[model samples]
Target: MENNNNLNNSEKKGIGRRDLIKGLAAVPVLGALAFSTSKKNAYDQNLKNSILRELNIDASTPPPTGPMAGDPVRLGIIGYGIRGKQLVKAAGFMARSEKEKLQKSALENPNDTRLKDFMEQENLNVRFTGVCDLFDVRAEEALDTVTTDDNKPKRFGTYQEMLASPDIDGVIIATPDHWHAPISIDAARAGKHVYVEKCMTHKVNETYELYDAVKTSGIVFQVGHQHRQTQSFVTARDVLRKNVLGHVSLVQACTNRNSDNGAWQYNIHEKASPETIDWQQFLGNAPQIPFNKEHFFRWRKWWEYGSGLAGDLLTHDYDRINCLFRMGIPKSATASGGIYTHKDGRDVPDVYHVVMEYPDFQMGTSQEKGKEKGFTFMYSATLGNQFGGRNTLLMGHDATLELLGNTITVHADPRSTRYKEMIKDKMIDPEVPLYSYNPMANGVDGVTSATAKYFANKGLLFTYRNGKRVDSTHLHIREWLSGIRNGTKVSCGIEEGFEEAISAHMTTLAFKLGRKIEWDADAKKIINVTEEEINQCDFITI
Candidate 1:
């Protein structure tokens, strides 16, 4: 309880920029020059110091140890909205100096009890190069928060200007769903690594464009499915790998929150207006509409910008299961639900459900090669009630695994084969969890907003590592930056993002067409639509 209190306080106070760059001052120019001799290494200490100096990071601060402590990466932020601000905060965690990090370690001398097992997760340190947003207020706010001492981020009138900037090594895209693919493609083509927020892409065709761009540019592209870093999902993946759960036959996931924010009724900024916001830029490829404060603030409520529950909520729940089980594209999907809760002028549904069929895939090597048993993946979401909270459950013959934020619980199945002997010997009981993994030894309760709590409980917002809570957003960003520096694939790379995008699109199509949609993996197209029917539909090309 005491540790959890410190956790909350640390979040509220935030880590200062001094703590972030203090350690870099100790690295000498000759030492950096010596390390730059390796052809495979991208770390240029002098160049990093110059960038830090420009950012107003004091050069006199002591240098601490880490992979890229002396060499920081230049980052430009695109779309400085809600999620973008949160991502920026997470990036700051990655920016903390190793010396400052060690000073807070649990073993050394924790200022709080929660510091145990906490070490600053390293990134190729990050320096904000610029910020881009359609809203002047949002852009200015983000620029101020992300900048250091006397350094101010260059304000870009458009995303293209930011992407074209030579000072930026990469860009983080947290724009609306529609702009993800286009901005990502542009960033890649501009020779910049990309960390793009989820929903992957808006139009189905653009998904392929973004995928191809990442491939062509050979850039490290990471989808913002930060849940990939959640310890519960990581443990669940191991459980699946161990074959202790037997063959998972059915998976259930849900998103339920009863709040104005959860329903996409975000508060409009007081400064929002035609003059303050570039409404034309925000419209992008969407149908042109006159500037309206509600439309600009509550964009997610409409289908023109957001993909409804399927893309916004379902994609999050589905991606975690996909990561755990390695479930690629589904065979077919059927969706049902409606805008039963929010009666506002929204085109998307407030309550939704989808069922996707998966072909028999090998869950274990022990299973017969020819034997196959198909399974169903289910996703349900509701904005009217916050009854059960959000979670993912995978049921198997041997046991059922329940995944919550930082917890993974496995309960025995009565008629299990693999666990039958243990059950009979009284080593395990069907009513009790056979195994449970909880990363948060000191629990956090009611420290955040209801909507934030909803996401946190679902392992989407933050995760625990080595008994200490760490922002998954930071971990995901670190992974992307590390991959770029090392020339390796990221956790949620282009192919993974493509798979997620296509799967979500299938659900969206199913809801839109009011019919089951089947995937023709070989042909790479939706099978149920005819050439004429495709033209008749207006949402997006399949």
Candidate 2:
């Protein structure tokens, strides 16, 4: 999961001091030899030990989620598109033929460990007995690959039909952003637990409606923020809570994708047509239009379907930070960008920038209280060039925490209030990281493509659990199932979803309206804009 970027940093801090001081690794032969003869490495070892003891930082991961036992949880898949297949695979249910293909791939290329990892995944004891998709090809493929002698899944024509079935215990919804709220809302009303993908809702009303639906129905609802299961995030939360970073005044998260797939120019299936695809159902609340394969596959390019970088991409980075600090929607947001790249008749901007202000927010420690009262979140993205790919930077008074992939490195600030004495004594160098966490180190990790690498770097594709690489999506799905069967609370529940949706909507609205948008936290609504104005920026009318 980690690249050489950590070592190539200008400071050249050790990967992780604890890993070095404890001599926990053997691969670094010279370092191992040094550790073996402490007489030669006493100064290095003592220095690391002194820093570790002085910092007293906790890099340990939280306990693993409860075991998946008891009767298998009956499940249904609502979307069989790009993300749907990944979600299905993460749910510990892969097609036999697909498994064989991965197996053959591993044999051909020793580095291809996808099959090994998939096979080693601890079975969650789940059954995909119901499958629903508007596309005929995708639906049949799901059946063809997933159906076995013991489990014969039914194919439902519509999500409504699938929700009505008594056979399905819960639903995994990976449909388009617009459909997320509608399907999840109905599924909640149907008394089934729901796991829906990001951006939670397409429009303003649905966000509030879906929240009420999940709340009133008392269903275990989980938003698809799989990074909640990432241990580095847990460590980041710990770091912030422990005030290791001091007063964080600015947060920067970026999305730099330079490929067609990364820009959401997905391949249009040859089988897709009026007869093979459910065009009307796909359109749903969007304007009725003639069948277009481009619209169907590259929906992320349209404001009518996807929220572009704001809802589709920004939300991922937003939620990642939001979960760490538990910071809700910002007080105001300003944004400006255009389709500077990939000008392929798409309305959503390929280059986007949104800045959100949290005036009263204070996740800081040991500074002038009023000085660290406010913070700003800036999300900058460009689909043209991915210069120095996704790295989330949290700047603070005492230290700067860099989150790349599933790893974290905290560099001490020279003018730190918390670590001033250490800096003065030359015990902690501001140039090197004070602490580091890398669960993905020396592991059988793979990043196959630009988009996959992007997700992997964002801790979306995979994360380590108890030192073992586990599909974060799988753990997320299992947590949702546990909420249903074991009465456990889900991590990214309706409340979190509400904040994420509203924040993303506000960012998008700021771009669409070309003005700063303010939120009335007490009123729990945007103060300056009406729902109609907020939702009227749709690109497609026909």
TM-score of each: 0.80, 0.91
Give me the runs in candidate 2 sitting further than 4 Å from their true place. 1-41, 538-542
Give per-residue CA lDDT, model 2, range 1-542, as digits (tens). 14433444556555555536456555578776777788657877787898877666778785666768898888899998888888999887676667888888888888777777787888888889999999999999888766867999999999999999999989999888878988999999999889999989888778889999988998889999998888888888888888888889999999998999999989998999899999999988887789999999999898778878988889999999998988899999999899888878999999999999998997667787577678999999999997774489999988999998799999999999988998898888999889999997768776677788888888888888767788889888888888887888788999899999999988888888889999989999888986568657643232
Assess candidate 1 and give its TM-score to the true structure: 0.80
Global lDDT of model 1: 0.77
CA lDDT of each prediction against the hidden true structure: 0.77, 0.86
Lowest lDDT block of 10, candidate 1:
57-66
RMSD of each: 19.0, 11.6
Alpha-carbon RMSD, candidate 2? 11.6
What TM-score does candidate 2 reach?
Answer: 0.91
lDDT of 1 by residue, 90-143 (tens): 787222333355455535543333223234544446888798989998888777
